[model samples]
Every structure is written in C-alpha cells, then in structure tokens.
Target: MTVVNGYEQSDAEKKLNILNLPSLADEAKKIIPTGGYGYIVGGSEDEWTLAENTKAFNHAQIVHKALSNIDSPDLSTNFLGIDLKTPIMMAPTAAQGLAHSQGEKDTARGVAAVGGLMAQSTYSSTSIADTAAAGNGAPQLFQLYMSKDWDFNKSLLDEAKKAGVKGIILTVDATVDGYREEDIINNFQFPIPMPNLEKYSAGDGKGKGIGEIYASAAQKISEDDVRRIAEYTDLPVIVKGVQSPEDALRAIGAGAAAIYVSNHGGRQLNGGPASFDVLPAIAKAVNKRVPIIFDSGVRRGSHAFKALAAGADLVAFGRPVIYGLALGGAEGVQSVFEQIDHELEIIMQLAGTKTIADVKHAPLTHFNYAD
Candidate 1:
C-alpha cells in the first residue's frame, strides 16, 4: 500500500477504488458523533438550497476541446496576491474540533502541507494565534463574524493581525443561523469551547441553543462596517456570502479587496440560490476588478472547472475537508485536497484547458431548469 500525505492509497482504493468524497464522508460517519456529524453535513430548514448547491452544477455543461496538445494541466493560481499550488482552498467552517481533537490547528497544517489556503473561522475551537502557529507560516485568512460589540471586533482583528494572517474574510450572510432541524432533533449544543469567543462570551450559554449564540452577532452589517474593518486592519477584506450582483457591487464599492460568493453552504438561508448559480452574474458585475472566492456545494473537480469557467477565480469547499479530518486528522485533510486536485487535473486536460487562466475561457453551455 502506497502512502501519500499519510493516507494509505490501498485503503482508499480498496474502499471506493478512489479517494471519493461521499465514501470519505461515509467513513467519517462511523466515527463522528451523531450531533457533530449532523452539524457538519446538515443544512438549514427544508434544505432546498443545500440540495441545489450541488445539483445546480448539472445545468451547466463543459464542452471538451480536442487536439489541444496539453499533457499536464497546471492547477497553480493566485488568490488575493498569494500564490497557491492549487486553486482549491479550504472554506471557513466553524467548530472543526467537533470533527477532530486538534480542530483548526490540524486543518491549518494540512492545508499548508499541500500549498493550499485556509480561512479560520471566528467560531473555531482553536485560537487564531495557535492555528497560525500550527500552519507554520502558510498563507491564511481570518473569517470574521463581526460582533455586535465594537470592542470585541477590534480585539479580534488585533489578534488576527498579530497572528500574521494574509487577509480578512468578512462573512455577511450568517448574522443569524437558519433553522437547522438536525440540531433541533438532536437538541445539540456545542460540545467544545470556541477559544476565539471564550473571552467575549457574556455567559457560559448552558441550556441556550447555538442559534441564539450566533444571533448575538451584529445583524446590521453595512458597507460602512466593511470600510472600517479594512481601514483598521490595513489588510485585504474579502466580502463573503454574496448571492447577487447588486451586493457584489456594493461590497466592491465599500472597499472590499475581493468578493466571496457563498450561501453559507445553505446554512444561512434555506431557499436562496445556490452559490454556483449566482457566480456568473456576480463575476460579470465585478468585471475583473478584484478576485472572487466561491464555495457552497463543490464536490468534484469538474465542479471546480465549471466554477472557474463561470468566473470564479478560486473554488473552496468545507464539508468534505471536515470528513477527511474526522477520518485521518491532518494527513486525512491533506489527502482529501490531493485527491480533489488530481481529479481537477484530469478534468482540465479533458476540457483542453492548460492553465487556470484558460479555464476562465473554456466554453460552457447553460441549460435552464424549471423552478
């Protein structure tokens, strides 16, 4: 059995004949607690958007070109001025400790090992400084859920800057968490401490629901807040959770360095359009002004290819990475990325795209789906 990034190749091959996402998730399910698995996999009420996030990819078809003399498609690209070995990055998912003991620290190490990027969430179990240390100088971004308390926000940003994060991701979608039925069914509560928020929490939050804790964040996020955070940190700010062109324009107008198109993995709004469904319009609206980071339901290399063709500069995913962590810790996380990048390389060659830039111009056919 071959060992790549600590994952046994034979084990992966024996189980699924490939390092597949669904198979990895099924393996993780056997170990992770029910509440934790639900938190990682389940989306908000009805889950219409959750299903659509991946299903929406079926509507777009990539036209494969023939006779383009490309043997190895390059996956290297840049995001927010940072050069990445692959355009596939890890999206910010909170409470990774629920999946593994080391939490964000282990995640950071795995992403760094693969030359990919990671955005640590404000609700992460590991502290910003510790996670950064674990990365050992990997290019990292801090995802901020602006607190209603201005002092707390400032303190959080201060900690992020001191930790040497490359940028700040201002997540604007989840001011209040959407109704997640799995959480209710399990009567779930955070089983671990969020080191980043521990100092600021007013109470221990015993008996209170996770949604209540999340709702305590500032609900009135505005463009002014965007400008303030950017000015304070003097770091590039990527406005996340944008679902429309208007909001994209507004974010750029507010001095955002980049636009992150996401629907919070369908965890914030139940009936919202899939993140992939809105990328083309938002990309058109941005008009090459800044980089665009996209996430939601990206399960395959072809999915990443489609997003790039639709105007996403970088594609990110969360659930699969967590599943990998649950199964093999940091090594498992690195293996998941390796498999996705390998799949992407094959897809790129099939599509006759030699570089990430070429993927932007790859011809695509769109089919309208009846709602």
Candidate 2:
C-alpha cells in the first residue's frame, strides 16, 4: 500500500496507476486477510482459466495508428440508458464490508466521484437504499439474484425502483455460487459482523454458512422464475454471466437490455472461456438489439482496449477495485477508476483513436467453443 497523504502505502509502488486498478496482484493480496482475500482473489483449481484471463490480453498487440490526431480522447458513454463520464463502471462484487468497514457506501461514493455507475449486488453488505443515498442517488444499476420466492424477488425489484436505481441487472450466471477452490480449502465465507447479514435474510429464514451453530444459505430459484423477475423489473434489465453466444442470444430473446459476458473472473466454472474470447461472437449475435458488456481479467488500459476492439460496449474489473477499496477506502477506490480511465485515454491516443467511436471494429481472429 503506497502511502499518499495519510493513507497506508501499498508496499510496492505501481506504475501506470492513474486508475489504481491493481497494476499488480500481490499488492492487492496485502490489503485484506487470507480468508477474505482468498474469497475475492482466489480462482478454481489449477487456475488455468484465471491465468488465461490475463494471458489472453498479452496475445493482442495494440495496432497504434500514429499521427492520427490522438489528442482529446472521449472516454464517456451511456450504459443501459444512463450516461457515464467514462465507459468504465464498477462491476458488482459482494462482501464489500469485508473489503473495508465503509462497505458499499464508500464504493458508491467512489463511483459517483468518477461519474460512473456501481452495480449493487444482491449480496451487498449495505442495502440498496443506503447505497443509493450514499451515491447521492446517482444513476445506479441494481444487480439481482434469483431467490426462491417470486414475491421476495418482486419486493427487491420494487425496492430498487423506489430507490431510483437506473437499471436492474439479473445476474443469470450465478444460478449457484461458483466453485472457489481456495474458499473450500480454506473454509472461508467472508463473514460479516452480526445483525447485518441476519437483517438481510432474517425475513427469509436463513443464517450464516460458516457459523459453528448455523447452516448454509441456499438460493433456490429455477429458470422459469428468472424470466418472471426479468419481466417484473421495468428498468433496463441486463442478464449477467452469459459466456456462450447461445446463452447471450437467449438472454436477449428473454428480454435482456444487455448481456454481461463474464465467467465470474474465472472463479466459477474454472476452465471456461475468458470473457474476452467469447465477446466478438456474443456482440455479433446481439447485433445492436441490446448492448454487450465484458469483464473478467481486465486490469489495465490494454485490457479495456482489447475488450472494445473485440466489441464490448462497456467493461469493468472486479478484484482490482476491491483491492483499492480495501487498501484505501473511497479515495483508494477513486484512484483505481482514475488509473484505468487514464490508461484508457493513453491507449485510445496510442491506438490512433480520438473518441470512443474511432475505437470500433479492430479486426480479430476468433477461437470458438461449443458450450
């Protein structure tokens, strides 16, 4: 943790940190304890997919167009009807309280400071209304879960709308939690202080998973219930966690305003295709009917650039931001976004583009997988 002002230092000084998106992973590891760190940072066994997520970016060489009026790059864009100063939005990650005491409230402030959006996860430590208040009720996106009860699902959607959330994202990918081998081996649940998690679930008759005297929380929802929730939310509902082109199309046909292509940062379903690999075809299948967003393994300008080149309208990085929030609080989180946004500008100029429009359709060879 590099000390700036009164904040604790991140040990190793990171270069290209205008966005503080963890240019290095080890620095991120130092911020949180082994249990919390393993839950957020660890991936599947062998970790081949997690490793490939980063390695996939290395294979793409930026074809910089020199002398192309590289000055004044426009990094702003609108996502799901909400305008953003930068195309980068904070991807939803749960257990933020475990990252920092301020939890999602501080994360919300950081997103507002940058004029970007933060997707409030269903598992948020802070409730949706509180996060909305923290962002000064800035245009936000509420990420949803497929809970067992339809009435409970309806209530959450209604609550988000009343809170003035701009859009609702149905996280279709987590039909169940991902297989995080580290947590399994380490016996971690990223526990929250009492009365909070209990408050979130007391109505549903659930308790902590790792409690010596408690039981695991189960999300009991079927595919039919997912469509019902999608239909229930009037906001632009995005279907997250679609890795296959077919799944992406299904989400669109099922009434998704956008598709968030992610494999849960390779934490779930180890050995799945990196979000980058499936982006091109997924984008093509949607064909402008709905937006296509990509994440999982993006930690720098080049990563964002590659996602754009590969046809992602918007992108976000999870663990990197978590590290910033855990390490430095709101200011640290702002630094993460700033570092990525700054790198995005440099990458835009170097790639011979001025505005985001100039960034479209760089050619790429696709390696397809049958899922």
What is the clash count of model 1?
A: 0
What TM-score would every model get versus the actual structure? 0.93, 0.86
User: Highest lDDT: which candidate?
Assistant: 1
Q: What tens digits encode model 2's per-residue C-alpha lDDT throughout 1-371?
A: 33322223233222224434555357767766677677778787778888888777765566867777558789888776778898788898876766677778888988898998888877786878888899996778888765554555666788788889887877766655555678777777435633223334433222333332122222553345446666676677778888887987777777777888888788767778777777778888878788877888888887898888887888877888878777667777787888888888988888887776667665544444333
| Model 1 RMSD in angstroms | 4.8
lDDT of 2: 0.72
The residue-level lDDT of candidate 1 at 216 comes to 66
Error of 2 at 62 (Å): 2.3
Residue 324, model 1: lDDT of 82
Q: What tens digits encode model 1's per-residue C-alpha lDDT throughout 79-182?
A: 87799999999999998877877778888988998999999998887899999999999999999998899888998899999999999999999888889999
